[model samples]
Target chain A: MALLEVKGLSINFGGLHAVDDFSIKIEKGELYGLIGPNGAGKTTFFNLITGVYKPTSGTILLDGKDITGKNTIQINKAGIARTFQNIRLFKELSVLDNVKAGLHNRYKYSTAEGIFRLPRFFKTEKAMDEEALRLLKVFDLDDEASVKASNLPYGKQRKLEIARALATKPKLLLLDEPAAGMNPHETAELMETIRFVRDNFDMTILLIEHDMSLVSVVCEKLSVLNFGQLLCEGETSTVLSNPEVITAYLGE
Target chain B: MKTKSKLIKPYTKKSFITYALLIAVFTIVQLILNFGKMSFMMQSLLVPLCVYSILAVSLNLTVGILGELSLGQAGFMCIGAYSGALFSSLMKEAIPEAMVRFPIAILLGGLCAALFGVLIGIPVLRLRGDYLAIVTLAFGEIIKNICASLYLGKDAEGFHLSIKSAADMNMAPDGKMIINGALGLNGTPKDSNFTVAFIILLITVIIAYNFVYSRTGRAVMSIRDNRIAAESVGLNITKYKLITFGLTAFLAGVAGVIYSHNFSTLQASKFDYNMSILILVFVVLGGIGSIRGSVIAAVVLTLIPELLRETIGNYRMLFYAVILIAMMLVTSNSKLKGRITAYTNKLKGLIKKEKKGEIK
Candidate 1:
């Protein structure tokens, strides 16, 4: 069984179909890439899977559990954590705290225990600090753990967002244009980080990117979305070489 | 060494400093009260200083920490004041001891405000920015008007409520009027004192700090910073917002109880739009998201007008306005703020160097 399975997922905004008949099956531990031109409904598809939008039709299954139209929180709890394309981070929070906020549900203590500073609060917080720091260390962000999330440079901010997402311990991780604004050096580092995340965390990964270089190097499987439809799907090299996909990116 | 450093993180040190500031203030006031001759005006302002401080701190939880603009905090305070005063007036004979009755009244006030907080927050939380502010301002006024016209009487037939007039309650001939419309609740127990108010203020600060440092605090701040990202990370947005809204309201309610108990005559009219704005000013002038700033701002701001009252009379408020604007300019100007921060850091570095030298 696939880690994530979507069957005929469709959504519309009145007269316009934002995502139409989009369906994909991601096997466990696969580095999948979703590439398209701007506004090809790539993000809308991610929104649909992450429950930011209710699908007009079809079903979604995570590890054989149907999670179709559940809310964002429910979908996240069901193990699909995603980073935003524009890097939405808790800007005011410290780097370490941003991850700890993501660790909210995994490690538990009631609000009362938190307010009163009970023994359980201490135990859980200590564990969370350790866990959050461990994740930070992986991204080489431990040295700047106490810095505010917004204060980090552009590339590191992207890394911090990814770190925060992984803190939720999701089975499948979705990265939306993770290297959106990075130069070649940072993009290369991000590629390494993405691969490392999949290998170490046993995470089935799916990412949407316009950066073809990052996609060709990191992605094992490729799905090209054009105008809210799946234009092509296959091995990264084959899909990139497809004349149809090329026409969608650079019109004939 | 690692464990020790982990144990005392940056926030822990800041939290200790806040506590120490409070304790230092308390001790200084106690010494002035016991040995030095305190002016009658200054003595009278003590409990009120605590009240305003608590109000400012609680408001900070909503305005600064939760990142919501609420103008109905005074409405919650009004609910708290009335509920607490009513409870104390009714239970006056049953629980004669101030030790027992006052605490219950405070809790009743806080819980009552919290109930209203959750109720109002459900609808109000849906709106954001100016719409939220306008709606909450309207709610505060609505509460004040309702309380103004409220009439209650208790007798053999049990408690009666009427909005028109006290006579509309139609209680038995021997029935006593509790809330005579517009007159407000009168002759309530004067159970609040400087010590009690100070302790409650301390507790409020402690709770604010704890909530900020806790898992829940981080979640609330996350929601404040980015609602979408917070939700994507598995946080229930509505739950955290309501929790923060309700908790801040609860503390405001606690402040209300202390407020009502300090005066023999309790009036809901006092908890108006200006009162809400006054608390907000403390949060703003202190620096948003700075809990320690809220406390100090409340104290200093509250003291300024009263301290100048005898000396300047009418011009005191004019002076107060000038100071408020000056404070806002200083706090808001990035260049000035940076320079201030630099000087403070330099001072701190010097102090650290001296301590190191002493150790060597």
Candidate 2:
């Protein structure tokens, strides 16, 4: 059985069909890529999957549990997490705090305990801090954890977003444009980090990348979208070399 | 090499020593003022300063931490003041004459206000930013209008009437509600003292500090920073925002109770839009997300008008507006960015030095 299954998923923004008849199934621990030309509903597909946008019609089943239209927080609690296309770090917060925010759902301290600064509050806070630091260290960002997230360089900021998502302890991680602005060297590093995170966390990853090279290098499987419809899906080399995908890119 | 010194220089033990010295100065000033046979006017000014400090800090919880602007602080305060006044007045007949009922009444007022906070927060907190501010402002106006229509005092014949029944009666020859409309609620016991006000202010600061430093506080700040990111990470924006709004309203209500009891008089007009704006001015002038700044702004703004009263007289309001606008502009401008950077750098330095000392 697939770890995630999207059956006949469609999303309409008023009169515009943003994503139409999208369906995909991913087995456990698979690294998959969703790619397309601009205005092809690639990001929209990610949004729908992450519960940012509900589908107009269809079912989204994670491990056979229907999670369609669940709020983002609920979806996150159900072990699916996604980074944004644009880095959305809490700019004014310390890097550690930004990662700690991802663990908010798992906190054991009650509001009363927090307000009173009880022993439980301290213990939970310490645990959260340790977890956040551990995630930062994995991303090689532990040294910068005390710094404000906004003050970090662009590449580190992107890495921080992934670290924050990882802090949620997601079973399935979605990366949106993880290499959008990175130099080739940085892109190479990020490709390795993605694999490291997936293997270390024992999770599956689905990433949206405009860098076809990075996608080709990291993703074992690929799905191509065109104008809100699935154009093709198969192994990365076969899907990228498909006539339809080549036509969609060349035409655009 | 120079970079390390630059990073480590500012946050030395001297930084803490300066804070302690500042605290000492404040205590000394407070002592000098309290010891002297201060005029009633001076006492009134100090009371408002203390009360407004609590109001500003509490309001910051919603405005700064939760990233929602609220303009109904005065409304909550009115609720607290009225509740406190009513509770104390009613208890006068039952409680021992020597026992202090003001503290209990203030607490009850805070509780009542907090209850109102929950009610108001449920619907209003669903809205964001400017929408939340507008709704809260409308709520404040509605509360004032309700209070204006409420009749809670004795009639000419010394007979007490329910506010609703009193409203149904024709206006007396003097155009008064026969129950004090616009004239204000009178005969409330003046039980708010400086000690009680300061104690409440201290508690408010402590609670706010604890909240801003907690996991939930971080979540609220995270929401403030990026609601989408926070939501994506499983943080419930609505729940945290409501909690913040309710908590702020409760504290505002406590301040209101203190204000009402101290004056021994209450007027619907006192809790109007202007009062809410005044509280906002305190929060904004202090610096958003800075509790100490809010408290200082509250005290300074409260005292500034009074200090200018003799020189500016009725024109004092114009001067106050000018000062507030100047402060806002200055704080928001790039000029203060240097100071803020300096402060943060100093703090970072101090933390590093402390860690190094502990390592040794």
* Candidate 2 docking quality: incorrect, acceptable, medium or high: medium
Model 2's alpha-carbon lDDT is 0.83
Please write out the lDDT profile of model 1 over residues A1-252, one tens digit for every residue.
Answer: 999888888899997887889889899999999998888899999999999899999899999999999999999999999999888999998898999999999999999998899999989988898999899999999888888899999999999999999999999999999989899999999999999999999999999999989999999999988878888899999999999999999999
TM-score, every prediction: 0.96, 0.89
Number of clashes found in candidate 1: 0
On residues B279-349, what C-alpha lDDT tens digit does candidate 2 reach at each position?
A: 99889889888787888888888888888997879999899889987887778878687788889999999
Q: What is the Cα root-mean-square deviation between model 1 and the actual structure?
A: 2.0
Q: What clash pairs does model 1 have?
A: none
Clashes of 2: 0
TM-score: model 1 vs. ground truth: 0.96
Candidate by candidate, in order, the iRMS in Å equals 2.0, 4.1
lDDT of 2 at A130: 75
DockQ of 2: 0.53
